[model samples]
Target: MSETTEKDLYAVLGASPSDPVQELRRRYQQLALQYHPDRLGNECSSEAESGVKKFLEVDAAWRLLSDQSTRRQYDLQRRARELKQDWPVDSTVCLDDMTWDEDDCVYTHSCRCGGRFSITEEELEEETQRKQEDVGEKEKEEEQHREAVVCCDTCSLSVYVIKDVKS
Candidate 1:
């Protein structure tokens, strides 16, 4: 997999997101053993592609969230979400060069070209920041993503170690 969406890894593994590392490891091991290819019958013989795929998915999700480093990152992301939710995202906008029309109770902007625009202050600020980020685009792309072969479609198997996941 080139990228894994920012999912709650613990939830994906069917565990509480705040589960202890040791518990997480134990649960993952149990799931991995249950899903091992050796335990699965021949794919061609059984014709259970979807079944095998689901098993692999459960195994992969468990493996990713069980590890210390990956688990920590997932936890941090979860915390970030909580913090962001608590932040007061004020949506009030400020209008530029517009007198409030009592009839409409909305501010309007008149352009030199005889055009008009209506926007809140927040929208304008957000737009300005987005424009700045675009103008300062990175010169070289960063390969922030790490590849992992989380599943064997032909068989239900997975590896927990980083090296194993990579191959």
Candidate 2:
């Protein structure tokens, strides 16, 4: 629903992920002014069109990042993207495929890269909470509790395990 569905807001505004709210606002204002269609009214049609598009993108990014709730959601999605990029998920495994370690209280699956993908109960519970908060009630009713991906710490490998419903 947010305009930042595809592009990274921070990148679009030329700000860091950890940038302060004031800094983000300042950057957005500058970019908005630079790319405003009205400011380039006398420019060539092609250039004006490009400027309009960029202006819209900048406005959308600011809209999503300026709101606290939307910003939190965006941050969560961004973090997930970064994690996936770093780990490069290699395979999917069901809960049955994993070996449960009682002492460590985690489910572990072996990775092809000589590492292991593990998920703890706490992580599963946290993920469930996040999902419930993210989706609408109607959507939640239609969706079943799904699997979670766990990444290997030592290598670019990962696995998906059906999160324990009881947890």
Candidate 3:
């Protein structure tokens, strides 16, 4: 793949985003050994050159993910990209603009087409649980503040709900 193409770093190291640091390190080492240029020594073929390029990419991914700060930044960027890809580009109402419905326990925002975009409390809670399960306690704490994307019930529009922090 071209360098400009968006690559999932976790995929490069053959690990999941939820994988522990040790597991990530292990996988990186395994991939490095398999793709290292020296490992394919005395070869001047295209395959050998490809292996070296892959090794470099794998090493770069590991370097970013192995560090807690860089990983957090990467996660934020990745999430933003995913949100853009998953939701309607032009329809992004902020949580502050939504009306909170006490009965339904959801934040609702009106779409231009008259459809309402809503996100229920249960949905936010479930998302939090999933994140906690995937990223572990430490990272979960660091990422306590997050935005949830909710779609309009009638139209293809969407909105972002900034969940209230729970005690």
Point to the candidate with the largest TM-score: 2
Which residue window of length 10 is worst by lDDT in model 1?
158-167
TM-score of each: 0.41, 0.62, 0.57
lDDT of 3 by residue, 5-97 (tens): 279998888888899889999999999999988899979999999999899999989988999998888888778567457555455455666
| Residue 95 in model 2: lDDT | 76
Ranking of predictions according to TM-score? 2, 3, 1
Query: What clash count does candidate 3 reach?
Result: 0
* Whole-model lDDT, model 1: 0.50
Off by over 4 Å in 3: 1-5, 86-102, 107-117, 120-167
Look at candidate 1 and tell me the lDDT of residue 34.
69
Lowest-scoring 10 consecutive residues by lDDT in candidate 3?
A: 83-92
lDDT of 2: 0.79
Q: What is residue 35's positional error in candidate 2, in angstroms?
A: 1.4
lDDT tens readout by residue for model 1, 68-156: 79767767767756533432321222333345656755445443344543433444445444434544646213322211112222333
Output the lDDT of residue 121, model 3. 68
